[model samples]
Target: MVYLDNAATTPVHPTVVQVIQDALINDFGNPSSTYRIGKSVKHALIQARKQLAELLNVSETDVYFTSGATEANNWAIIAQANKSREFGEGHHIVTTAIEHPSVTNVTKYLETQGFDVTYIQPNEEGEITVQQFLEATTDKTIGWIAMAVNNEVGSILPVQELGEAAYEQKLWFHVDTVQALGHLELDYQALKCTSFVGSAHKFNGPKGIGFLVYRTYQEHNHLEPLLHGGGQEGKMRSGTENVPYILGMVKALELAKKDITSNFEKFEELQAYLLTSLDSIGISYEINGDQKNRVPYINNLWFNGNIASQMLIKMDLDGVYISAGSACSAGSLTESEILKAYYPNQSERWSQSLRISFGYQTTKADIDQFIHTLEKITKGKIDLWHSNK
Candidate 1:
């Protein structure tokens, strides 16, 4: 199948798989052990952390490893909330409505625990303006949470500018950079964020391994351990380190860092091909997010009168695969919150929205084939709508 669901997850690279296999076989000793084998494993773990730090352009001391992006996001939010509670300083958290389930759900959980959460809505183009974000901040607001790049619509948020605003307000800023890590060049020194989260799988790395980057070691930003045990990852995360997965993640990130430029060029070619074919089909479509600020790899399309799910099925039958909106809300197949945020009171029109994403494995031919199938589905849907009328 011509898979277009890179946003959901990606297949692990062969080189990464090989590294993982090697680690599991030869470096199975516990990193905490004092034996020789343990010493070697410990060294490997440190190297992995340093490699990840290099990729993020942060100090190894500031980087903490987690199971995945969800866990990292949870830890960041809860830690900041706990700190706020302790000081009675800033009990309010500011986030956007277009955030992923990981960020949104964590914020919702915080609300239940007596923390005030302000959910800011994005503009019509799925972008949160710096002014709006600043307006949301108040004296009680402790943290500003937003994504560097939206996972569903792929719109690039002005993270540097937003983070600066949060800093100017003396508030902690945390951004979910899971989707943006490898696709976008992140200059950690320039971002000026209090914290950031990224997943390895999004960059063709191994699953179950991710990292959190924080600016300083201030106790207010200090996170209470989410998992309690042998105290891995600076006592912030517990349980034994997944050394094999960590090593593989390092390899994948290095690969992405080396190849980002060419990969972006390839995505541009695919986008051009897709838009050209869609235009040729005479399909009336609108881009869901701000094209000028969107990542090159994703295009959220709104076909005027066709149901996205039905169109997805048609494309699947023709050996193409795509997602509706958020993969985290899999099987629900409901109207997307991101769409609703942009076009309020237009729930009926959401069924026509489709999220098409590409990845390292994607090609021009794949876009051509998918577009051909889309045309057939669009024409058939139009005829059916007219018939019912």
Candidate 2:
């Protein structure tokens, strides 16, 4: 099968799998225990934290493990909001319209709790500029949450610039880097965000394991804990850590860091080849998102007058796997919020969109097969629509 839905989740690397399996069998002791077996597990956890810290160029203490990006995001946003309340700061939050549901939904929930939220909309290119975020900010704005790269369209936002601006304003800045962790160059010092979230599954690691990079400071002392039990994760997140998955995630991160440059080059070549092949087929389509600034792995296309669900179903039948939008909202027949944010007035294009993403396992042969299959499916759909018209 030609799998092009890597943005949703990637196949775990063999090395990562082996690491997890070995840990599960040999290091079953709890990191919180005081025994020798537990000491070994604790060592593994520390090493994992060190490796992830090195990968993102951050201190080991800053990396806090969580169930996934969703929890990390919720923790960051809600904790900041709580801190604002405790410190008598503003109750307003600044975020973008194109944020993943994790951020958007949490911010919406905050609104019900007497907090104000400003969702800055993106331009036609599916990009929220630094200026847009700056303009949205106010004295009442307590924090800002924006994604480093859009999950559906791969649009790279001005995260570093926006984070710097947030720092200047003394507002907490949180970035969801789930899509950017493995695909983009991550410099924790340069981004300057108060915190960032990432998932292991997005980067060829085990699922249900992710990390939050929280920059600790005296001002953030009032941040509330989400899960309170064992007082783990620097007392910010409380739970018995999943040592095996953490080890697996660290191995996957190491591999991704080691081969990021080569993988990026390969994805770039594949993206170019796929676009050229689509052009050769004379297909009527428009590329969604900012083509110039987007990541090489993800390509969102709008095929004229085509229903994304139908295309996705047909492609699945033909052994070509792709997605209509975020995997979290895949089965929904309605227009995607990401596309709607880009073209608010032009609603017709929303249903016509599909997201094709690449990964380390993707190949030129896979692209060629995908293009051929897509050309056939799109042509047939166009013919059927025209005949009905």
Candidate 3:
């Protein structure tokens, strides 16, 4: 099967799999136990935490593990709100309309609790600018949270700009780095955000594992723990650690970071090849978001009609896998909220979008097969894909 839905999730690398398998059988003791095996496992967790901290350029104490990006995202928003209450700040939050559902839903729930949230809309680019964030901010606004890179359209948000703005305004900042993990360089210090969340599954690692990095020096650090049990993660996030998955996750991330530059260049080459192939095949498509300001990993496009669901079904049956939008909402056949936020009042555009993402193992052969399959699928209806503009 030719898989192009990497933005949704990636297959685990062989090395990561091996690491997890080994730990599962050999390092089965719980980190919270005081016995010899437990102490050794606990030491491994400590070392893994330190290793990840070095990769992100943060202190080891700041890294806390969770189930995945979803949990981390939920914790970030709620914890930030709780911190706002502690500081006596206004019940207001600043976030983008294109944020992951994990974030958007949390903000929506917060609104029900009397916390006003200003969701800044993207300007036809799937990107939120610092200016928009600043304009949305008020004296009552407690924090700003946004994804470092949009998962659907792959638009790279202005994280550096927002981080600086958050610093200047003394407001908390949380970045969802799920899409940014393997695609973009992760420097917690350089990014200057109060906190950032990551998922291991996004970068060819095991699923059911992720981490959150919150700066200890920041005022937001004083917020109470999001989870309470077993006193794990310094009482900030409680629960016995998934030791094996933690080791595998750290391994996968380190591997990605080790070759980030070369991988980025390779993805650029692949992206250019994909567009050229589409042009050569006479399959005209309008890129769904900012053409030049997106990660090469994801290519979201809007074809002629409301055929995203149909094409996705056909592609899956034919062994060439792709997706309409975010995997969490892909089954619903509903219009993409992300696309709607980018192209307001354009239901046709939102409904006819496809998100094709690339992984580290993706190759020119995969792209060739995808273009060939797409051409075969749209043969008689080729003119429909041939846009005037």
Candidate 4:
């Protein structure tokens, strides 16, 4: 089947699988143990952290491994509120309306506990401007969290601008870089954000492992540990470190970094082909995000009158896999909250949206097959509509 759901997750790379297997066979020791096996595993975790830090352009001490981006996102934002409650700097947060549920829900949870949150609306282009962010900031705002690239629509946020704005206001900045990692070049030092989170699986690595990178350890705020027991990840995150998965994740990033330029070029070519084919089919589609400014791998389209759920099922049946929206909220009957926030008056248009994402393994042949199947499906539906007319 043609899997176009990279925004959800990706199949682990063969090299990554091999590395994971090696770690399981050779590095089976608990990282917290005082014995040699433990020491060895600890070293492995340390080395993985260092490699990830190097990729993010941050210090090794600032990189903390976690279960996934969801956990990292929760830990970062909630921790900001918790710290503020203790130290009394602020009780407010500013985040875009398009945040992944990981950030959106956590912010909502904080709001229930008396912390105020301002959800900034993005423009029609599915992009949050620097000015909108600056306008939303208040003295009570303790932190601002947003995604580098939107998980559903693929719009790239002005992270550097947001970081600069946050810096000027002395507010903590956290970015959910889950969709942007490996898809874009991210330098935590360059962006100057307080923290950024990335999940490995999005870049052809194994699931259940990710990392959070802080810009600096000095003056850094701590989270109330989500999992307690072993004091792993410097007590920021606690538990036995998943060395095999971590190693695989590191190798996946290594591969992505080495071949990113070529991969991006290939995706752009595929995107152009797909768009051309869509145009040729005479299918009515609205590009959801800023097409010129999005990541090369993602394309969110609103098929004017078609039901996204029906199209997804039909695509799956035709051996072409696409998605209705973010995989995190896929299969839910409700409309996309992100779309609703941006196009509040257009429920029909919003329900018709679908997100097609590419990955390292996507190819021209795959796009051709998908476009052909789509054309046939849409043509049959159009014929039926005219008959009814």
> lDDT tens string, model 3, 276-367?
99898788798887666789989998887548877776666556788888887636777889898889977788878888899888999988
Per-residue accuracy of model 4 over 1-389 as CA lDDT, tens digit each: 78888998999999999999999999999988999988999888888888888877778987888888988888777777788666888798888898999999999998899998889887766568878877887877788887899988888988988898888888888999888888787666878688889898999999999987765422647656668887887786777889999999999998998888888888888888888888987877888866567877888889887787777767776778888777785457568887887788888867899888999899888888788767766766423222211
lDDT of 1 at 367: 83
Whichever of 1 and 2 has more lDDT, that candidate is 2
lDDT of 1 at 111: 89
The TM-scores, one per candidate, come to: 0.94, 0.95, 0.95, 0.94
Q: For candidate 4, which ten residues in a row score worst on lDDT? A: 380-389
The segments of candidate 4 whose C-alpha lies over 4 angstroms from its true place after superposition are 216-220, 330-333, 381-389
Q: What is the C-alpha lDDT of each candidate?
A: 0.83, 0.86, 0.85, 0.82
Candidate 3: what lDDT? Answer: 0.85
- Where model 3 places Cα greater than 4 Å from the true spot, the runs are 124-126, 216-221, 380-389
Clashing pairs in 3: none
- Candidate 1 Cα RMSD after full superposition onto the native fold (Å): 3.3
| Superposition error at 179 for model 4 (Å) | 0.7
lDDT of 1 by residue, 207-326 (tens): 788988866536556767788989888887889999999999889989888889999888888888888888877778888876678987888888877788777767766777898898
Q: Which scores higher on lDDT, 2 or 3? A: 2
